[model samples]
Target: MKRKINSFSRKITNNPNLPAAHAMLYATGMRESDFCKAQIGIVSNWYEGNPCNMHLDILGKKIKLSVINQKNLIGFQFTTIGVSDGITMGTPGMRFSLPSRELIADSIETVVEAHHYDGVIAIPGCDKNMPGVMISLLRLNRPSIIVYGGSISSGFYNEKKLDIVSSFEALGEKNTCKISEEEYKNIIKNSCPGPGSCGGMYTANTMASALEAMGMSLPYSSSSPSTSENKKKECKIVSTFIQKLLERKVKPKDIVTKTSIENGVKLAMCLGGSTNLILHFLAIAKSANVHFTLKDFQKISNQVPLIGNLKPSGIFLMEDIHKIGGTPVIIKYLLNQGILSGDCLTVTGETLHENMKKIPNINFNQKIIYPLNNPIKKNGHIRILYGNLSPEGSVAKITGKEGIFFRGEANVFDSEEDANKAILNHKIQTGEVIVIRYVGPIGGPGMPEMLKPTSYIMGSGLGKNVALITDGRFSGGSHGFVVGHITPEAQSGGLIAFVRNGDFIKIDAENNLLTLEVEEEEIQKRKKEWIPPLLKVKKGYLYKYIKTVSPASEGCVTDQF
Candidate 1:
């Protein structure tokens, strides 16, 4: 049946009126409502001869028919067909089995080549999807625009409005005790109104924000809601921008320079952005053949202060950011301070300095973005530390922290699962360093964020006092004194492999040190018996991921040297 549908689709593609220039490669992880609303035509293209239907499934039940035809389909053969895949997490019963980053990158390459695509607009949200799409665009090196599915409208809970991440944390806490299932469902529904971006400063939203700050997206593109009329307008604008980009022969490399990446890093720090940005930015810089390291982040952090009052750091949403002039304002601030590369070009066909001039009367009032003089926190960059525990250096965010930057006994958990179990059992004590190993690149394989444990630590009200040290990365929304991305991971016999339970660990962000208070002889003795954990994926993408995924310090990106 699928073969039949493919045959029919091929026939349609062969029609000469369906010009290749009009062909827009709209790639997305989910079937967004904005995509459905921006469509023009639809037909029952035979999918495996099973008569698979295609239409807007907004309520997940009724299909809103925009176009229908039975006979004489030959006359309307020139009509465009919008491809919407149900690959996002929001889809019912859909597990997070989307293709790997490299696979998706290759797929986009194939799409651009096979379709002879003149222009492309990517609709990507969520952590993995954004980077996957961005990496693909970078490889394609074509005239492309990323249309982010924006954040959902704020949801109300307990008579107070709450964002997605906070809502989830609240739900997880509420579930621990007694709560009506119906109420939980209501909160879930309220939290997610429609097709949109992820709730927190998780990798998905943070990457979008970084892309915007880096001048890869149109103005206000990062925060527009997926269901808003403005979002539809932005899609049209992106389509138009793609045409312009093609006409001007603007490639991805034109916008993604080293300076542009520096701009992105500065913005990420100011917003107290996701730790995932560290990995994604590193991967992006690698694709561009630009040399960037974790140490560079530490250097940049010393100059840039955390100004954006967003979650995990402060109380604000992306919408508020949009209202306060967005990246343009932030860039202007950095440029004024002689911190940003003013010559960097943006998607708007203007240099970073030139774009700032376009915005009129930008305000830096305390309610919106705080000024550098009165920053929410100073030094927003993720710090890199090295010692006996992480000989090759580990990453940590020290922005907004208010306690002593000192050492504590390591309560090591070999994996996040063990750490979480201990947290749930209340075995974790305050001021003790929580060491989460085996969750690094080769450990979790993809290095899934150790957010669950971090949240549990926060929810237990010990977040202010305790410190989290892990080989894995944290979400952009994650704050506090959390150390991540211990390089030469335990799986590869890095220094983290020598750590034992109750070992004294020291983290001095001020001095850039993350050392285990153990003698060199004792560490050498443990290294002899320290066996690296073996990954057993024999087939599929996970196998490729395990083989190619770099360490957290290297951005955890796959297939790149």
Candidate 2:
């Protein structure tokens, strides 16, 4: 093969004075001629710690082998850390989850930069891993590609499909005596039968689809199941594309432009994606130096229709959508409606329009992805709201079924644990808005997901009756009239800390408002007496995170804080 591209490897390989560098390469089994080839770093977030990433070691090896087969390229595989959000949620362990995103991104960046690899192939399987890897790629500004580890195949129980959320919700059912203890055990046992991210339109699947829409991953990459033969087939094709990317000097920043970011947001809106996207996208935008904001998200949310009939808010699972077709089918629908920008460039070294030209039109016969004209919801379910409560902003995922407007009295708790206990104990009532405070980035010191508490609300049959507002966030599987990512969090001395029980709170998704019905003078008095609580962690990563992490509005990115 003829070489036509410059490589970062040349910095180390071509320097005769760097005998140690050459020695290291030789020690790793590199041949004389191999030194001249482009060095590609295949970064893997593989660990046996969770099902989401358990099989990634096998996938990473396959990717390395594929890269080895590509002439004029030498593949070097490296590992990064990945925290399992599902395993950590609701525990003190959960504080490490959001901070893990930074760790993953920083670790990958450190390895790739230190090694001087010319390009990268990031394989991220979980929520933070996807954005974490993407952020590093954008920061590195190298020829790169992403291959999602893919969604898990849904587990079956009692002739019904189940995923991780099913297990979580089962805990609530057991507490409420909605199901027998044996039945709850059965759901837990079968909820996750094998490897892959959670099989819903949760954060993992949502980020994957959003990345694909933004032209990072290949079409259908987001929707493939982890154990599928198709996923392996897709892995084999990435090495060839990475070579093309390197040859053309196509970097992530070139592909992840403002229009492309908007494309991603538009797709997320239609998919009814996790509220986490707002946090992740803001971080990605900062890394890419794109001028995107939550306001930008609200702009797209206003126009895009919620067409995907999948997941926590809908009747189908990701596997169901995969059966009909994958993310491409959904993209095809959006493209037809002119909601997506076709002119954007993708990792395939072709314009999105060019790529979509090859994708078959949306299969209207499928129920998993609805047509735009007859969407599940007419407007996007991601509502970005601003009011006295969230002076900066807050995010609310409201499927119309939850009702567009909710007005209730305050039910305040300083931590998710307290609120969760209250819900399980049946202390939370109808016509109440549960305010979970001091759990934001600075307060929780890691901004844990409120999945446990939210799932309890649903299991306790109060999903629609009582709304939960928080400074933390919700899992993609979490539904109900819940609002989170409240800015100026309690730790930051936001009015949320001053919220008292019996205070009136109103959430209006239709108008995009989050209002705390307290007089300004009274709120001022409360603020004067309020003292921020001590952080849960005082040392290690959580301590550093609390000191440096930005607010939720800025994606809680630590670098710029």
Candidate 3:
């Protein structure tokens, strides 16, 4: 840690070009010695509101300590909005959730480009911020590093593991008279005990794991529990690792490649991550300017086995994954089995194969990560269905427990609120296909996730009997026979708009079909009668987002396709 004066510090250009810029920095008490050091930007998502990103400032401090105190580099921290999906779920407020990703990306790009920092580090939490930061890094194409905010430890109630999902479903159980109001209150009190991301393999944790698997993050850092010593150590470890990445001139474009995107999909499939991962990764690939397709995710899912035993689809939490050797063991086991490609270069400035060599071998006795031959499922947990309803495509999380196929009467709801009410009132029949629509990108104006509704059905003891399909997306914690992201979404005049309450709908996951079981003439007749909704957001971000955002099939991005 000796200050060699002009070693790495001299890398900064203190050229006598702009006196105002120099004066502004110096007026803040930046000494000449500090000016001589290389400048690094820390795009931090820190806020006092929610658990997901509350501790990001703490992580930023650790990162700055390494960059300035240990590596003799000047680090500047910038803050951005980190919207809480958990806080906004099931409300009109949720409409702003997905849109926050765009703002997060734009903010970083604006700051980093304006500052012209040599190296950048993004510390993110929650569903949107993680991918948002990565997209910004990809756009900048600078020497960059991404550190996940990490997972929250699980809470327990009556010796049973409880997390945010438990609280969400407990309400449904109370309404259905399955659980008493007293028990529901107990769940609300105990489900999420402290600060961290939602304690499940949901979007936040899913995107974190996906980023690690894709080589955007330092290996094993993504699994560290939030606010733990391990997480703080991870933040400190990153300063040195990122410096190496900077020294090697390794950009995000170098680390995030076509193969790497596939690797991300593989991890998502195995982990049964939120369907939002596909949307975020698609946006990430678009930002990186890599030619990745929605089908590409399906292709990788076909080969990758569902290995991680983490939930809302499984028993363990992400903290469980961290205890049993972190994400590297999952990568190493998959790579060893020839499922994941070892060729993708990672931020470690080495190939994924060499990176896997650093982590300890998977504990054979460990229950978190299972062996290849005896997987949680024979194939990956995710599936893509296409038929009359979703002509372009749709997504489904097919846990082996939900039989391969379902044929039931369609019970259509124009919105999630109606569907949610039906579950509580026992109005939704057991053999019914709940169809929630008009909530895609342009529809909901942000494509708010349907975690609440799906969790409600499961908690009401209708998970095995009922099937829910929507033009919206699902939270990673949403399990059961749920399908989402129906392409050419209902707002865009898709066939899902034509589904009537009494129509017989069938879902064949094994064959990848979501048929309406109606005649083509009927569909054509209904198409002629159908009229798209005229949404009036007046003048806000939603107004602009509605005008340009693409369909869910296209990642729900606002690019001018």
TM-score winner between 1 and 2, please give it.
2
Better of 1 and 3 by TM-score: 3
Model 3: colliding residue pairs: 9-37, 274-476
lDDT of 2 by residue, 96-117 (tens): 8899999999999999999999
Model 2 local distance difference test score: 0.90
Residue-wise lDDT of candidate 3 within 49-93, one digit each (tens)? Answer: 988888899899889887877445678888988888888889888
Model 3's number of clashes is: 2
lDDT of each residue in 265-355, candidate 1, tens digit only: 8877777777767777878888777899887887887888877667765677776666666555666777787878879877767777787
Q: Which stretches of candidate 1 lie over 4 Å from their true place?
A: 1-99, 171-189, 402-404
Where's the lowest-lDDT run of ten residues in candidate 1? Answer: 70-79
Q: All candidates' lDDT scores?
A: 0.62, 0.90, 0.84
Candidate 3 stretches with Cα past 4 Å from truth are 1-13
**Candidate 1 pairs with clashing backbones:** 1-47, 1-48, 1-49, 2-48, 5-46, 274-476
**TM-score of each predicted structure versus truth:** 0.80, 0.99, 0.96
Q: Candidate 2 has what TM-score?
A: 0.99
Ranking by lDDT: 2, 3, 1
- Candidate order, TM-score descending: 2, 3, 1
